[model samples]
Target: MVSQEKKIKVVLAQFPLETHNRGIITVAGMLRDAGMEVVLMGNARAEQIIKVAVQEFADVVGISSYCGGELALGDELLTMAEREGIRDHTVFILGGIFPPKDAPKLKEIGFSATFPPSATREEITSSIKSAIAARSLG
Candidate 1:
């Protein structure tokens, strides 16, 4: 759990081709209610997401994917973060339409967590909180 002493900041984005913003919006509200700051990037390019994350001084970058291309995009996002020198500073998470079988691949690609379609609000919020706490410590 993230202590109330600091407000965690998260940047939420979806894979470029995905237009479904409802989940992202709902997650944003949940994060805010949990006392974290959130910025939703609504279907953005990897570079754009990274730029905003850096600008916002984000603690976590949560990306939602629904088109089965999360593995490639997740790898690209991690590579970009490494190149930009923010790999260790930011935690990356993937949510929406992910299969249980692909969770390991997502983690190997540097995603901090992967939430399947049925993930509850508590699970998502707790994951974000945990990531933020871990990042702050290390």
Candidate 2:
């Protein structure tokens, strides 16, 4: 694990779809275990995610979407973040079932990182740490 002088705060947005919660919860556990502060926002809209991120002073907003509408939702999240003026300060991440081919599009929409459902716990945790560190550097 990377040596962190300050704990990174991450807010994981729950997908509106019911079946997707399992992996999101698992990732939340992994993130919390990795020495970061994690808040799992249950069934939240993009607006709520942005609001909560600001309120929590979160460094990253992580979403695990497995319902196949990630592209649209991810775009919406970015738009909301931009509108709320947190687009630069907050790192947005997506994991779970997003097609690999669409990662570039997601990045273009301001996603800091994107992970497939095949990502291991180590990968998810490491990506969050890396994104937070990168954002801090810039």
- Best TM-score goes to which candidate? 1
Name the runs in model 1 displaced over 4 angstroms: 1-4
Q: RMSD in angstroms, candidate 1? A: 2.3
For all candidates in order, the CA lDDT equals 0.85, 0.83
Clashing pairs in 1: none
| TM accuracy, model 2 | 0.90
- What overall lDDT, based on C-alpha atoms, would model 2 receive against the true structure? 0.83
In model 2, the runs with Cα more than 4 Å from the true position are: 1-4
List, residue by residue over 1-138, the lDDT tens digit for candidate 1.
Answer: 657476788899997898677778888888788788889889889999999998888889998887788888888889989988898978899888867789999988888888887777789888877876787798
80, model 2: CA deviation in Å? 0.9
Residues 1-138 of candidate 2: C-alpha lDDT, one tens digit per residue: 567588888898865664758788888888888788889887888888899988888889998887688888888888988888888888899888867898999998888788887788788788877777787789
